[model samples]
Target chain A: MPVNSTHYLFLSLLLFSIGIMGALMRRNAIIILMCIELMLNATNLLLVAFSKIYADADAQLFVFFIMVVAAAEVAVGLAIIVMMYRKVHSVDINILNRLKH
Target chain B: MAIYDILFWVLSAIAVGCALGVILSRNPVNSVMFLIITFFAISGHYVLMNAQFLAIVNVIVYAGAIMVLFLFVIMLMNLNADVEPQKGQLVQLAGVISGGVFFLVILAAIKSAKPELMDKTSTNIGLISDLGKVLFTKYVLPFEISSVLFLSAMIGAVVIGKKEETKPLTHNGEEE
Candidate 1:
């Protein structure tokens, strides 16, 4: 049996849900960032699958742009994380309460 | 089942399992390792979809570059399970419940929507050559704009991350 787009869609859904759970439950900022990456990857998978289903290249191009943005986002995000760590001496998100004051 | 179907099942299983591992691992380093595995598995799916260029880019950008950055930060932070305090059990339970609800709603939405399937004629759309044509001809503006975005991101990261050096002496060369 050939694989259908639904298979890929379901897989994306599962991965995305897991990423959401991790982002919500994790206290460490780094893990939360990683979870966000997971969510992005899930979207990429669904886009590529849809591109295949429709026999179109536009969605794949969109995936390419998403990857580019994700790369740039990761660079800046990790830099901010590093700076936060330097200030607080911890990677815990709960310790980020200084902004609330 | 055909080979492609088998590959899909196996790779999806690996990807989902690694995703779970990423969240559940106690050590942040372990979570990073699992995340790398998840990226590799997703790249495998890209290959099965005949997106060769994307598969290669996914491996290179995500597993190679981005994940290495994550690992370097993890090492620099020296994070462990013990150092990071856990949230309350109630909060953890609430998070899990909310995520589950979100997943169920999206799944239902996916099931309700019908996507028309096109005939498979080896479109070769996912090929690098074809993708380059469309990207350059049609999406050229966004492509160029993304480069500018990357440049700005680089400058911003450097500005934010750079350390400040304190000068001990005044301009008059006198220490207060």
Candidate 2:
């Protein structure tokens, strides 16, 4: 059997699931952020696959925009994490619950 | 044909395996390294798909810039496996089960819908010149708007990362 869009779809889905598991199982904020990036990359792979299959430039452009947004998100998220670390001295998410106090 | 198949399998395997390593690793720095590998593998997939521009941009932006930023943050905090935190076994099991169920559902749905999606024509739509033309001509407004978004993100990152001025900084030496 040759590689096809379905194969790419399956692979992307599997990667996405792994990212979700990582995000859910990790207590460290940085690790969860990495998992989110993994999920984004999974979707990017799928988008590129579809773009190739359909010969559509639009989807590829969308992927470019997605990368832009992901970059910005990571920047702000890491800054927030740094601030949180400065205050609470740990990147653990459980401490965020006490943020209201 | 065989080579294409082999390349796809190899790239996909690297992507998935490194992604697994990213989450499984106890150290933030290790996770960053694994994610970088995963991004590189994804970039290879882009190349295999003939999205050459995307492949290069993915490598430059993702593996080079973003992952390096992640690495710097990790190292800045001096994070190691000793300080790594993990969820309880029960919570982790539940998460895995949920993600597994979601994957199985999507797989079943896509398996039934696969054939209708295989016949689209391929073209040189992934070329840089073509993408640049579309980006500047058709998508010019959004392109410019993305710049504005980037500016805001830069400001936001700086603002959030900046030290509070409420507590005044004391000079360690006599002011000239």
DockQ of each: 0.73, 0.72
Compute the DockQ of candidate 2.
0.72
Report lDDT (Cα) of residue A47, candidate 2. 92
lDDT tens per residue, model 1, B55-98 = 99999999999999999988877774456788889998999999
Clashing pairs in 1: none
TM-score of each candidate structure, all chains considered together: 0.93, 0.93
What lDDT does candidate 1 reach at residue B40?
Answer: 98
Candidate 1: residue B100 Cα off by (Å)? 0.1
**Interface RMSD after interface superposition, each candidate:** 1.6, 1.5
lDDT of 1: 0.89
Tens digits of per-residue lDDT, candidate 2, A1-101, equal 87778888899999999999898888999889989999998999889888887777999999999999999999999999999998788999988886486
Per-model lDDT: 0.89, 0.88
